[model samples]
Target: MSALGMQSSILVGGFQYWDSRRKGRQFPARGDLDPLIDIPRLVPHIILIDVRHDPLDFRFRLIGSAVRRNLARDYVGHWFSEFPNYSASSNIWPRHCAVAESGRPMLQRPTYVGPNKDFIYVENILLPLSVDNPGWSMQMMFLEFISKRH
Candidate 1:
């Protein structure tokens, strides 16, 4: 929340929703996530990434409506490499891998967008979700754009 200032209620709210369902586990399982119940009003700000390690792939499981609207693109079922000249993906993908490796939630705030169609700021909250075994299979991302007004 540095340059972006305090965490927006949307982010806090998302965290609360995610944490409440944690039940003391390292991370919540993908099945535990119910979009309608977990983030009822922030669908556009949410994203789900399917993680793979055999060849290291990060594919989009879901893309929030808001993201599609703001980016003017729908990345569902696409990997970051599928899009070229997109700097944000380059910056974000590594952190995602880190979260998967650590099996912990990671935060990257005040993510400045550099003239990518429009100037914007976003905060990335990546929560690792595991289906079975000890490796993470899903990355529940709350990619929230902080209001530029503040």
Candidate 2:
């Protein structure tokens, strides 16, 4: 619900949709999310990540069209550590780790440093998805682009 403070309606709607799916649980189950029926408009900006333990790695489960276009590549089956042009020091890796460990939602505005330099910034929200698990196993990310570099 705190996502209301966000300037982007898409993010707000996405968060609200996620909140609605909780249904008294700490987090929603990944299977409960039906983007096509519920938040169709937000699908283009959505990304699904699978949280891997052991060494605490993250793998892309799904990537929306807008995200693929922005990155200029499709990373559906790639790990975060293998992101092109990004080293292990990338902030995204740690952020995903924190969300998985904390079982909490995170809203962030990160400077655009991806393959698409034309982007100025990105406003995104990461929501944890748990299914009868002690910790989150999956995460749903909704990103909203702010401005252009020009």
Worst 10 residues of 1 by lDDT: 110-119
On the 0 to 100 scale, the lDDT of residue 16 in model 2 is 88
Please give, for residues 54-139, the per-residue lDDT of candidate 2 as tens digits. Answer: 66777888988887788757789988878744335876777887888888888888887667666788998999997555433889
* Model 1 spans > 4 angstroms off: 1-6, 85-89, 110-118, 132-136
lDDT (0-100) at residue 48 of candidate 2? 92
| TM-score: model 1 vs. ground truth | 0.80
Worst 10-residue stretch by lDDT in candidate 2? 83-92
Those runs of model 2 whose alpha carbons end farther than 4 Å from true positions after fitting are 84-88, 115-117, 131-136
Q: What shift in Å separates residue 118 of candidate 2 from its native position after superposition?
A: 3.7
Predicted candidate 1 versus true structure: per-residue lDDT over 1-150, tens digit per residue: 344343667666666677777789977777777878657897777888888776676888788876666664677898766766332357666777798789877777755544354435777677788777443398877766655565
Query: Would you list the C-alpha lDDT of every candidate in the order shown?
Result: 0.71, 0.81
Error of 2 at 20 (Å): 0.1
- Clashing residue pairs in all predictions, respectively, total 1, 0
**What residue pairs clash in candidate 1, if any at all?**
44-66
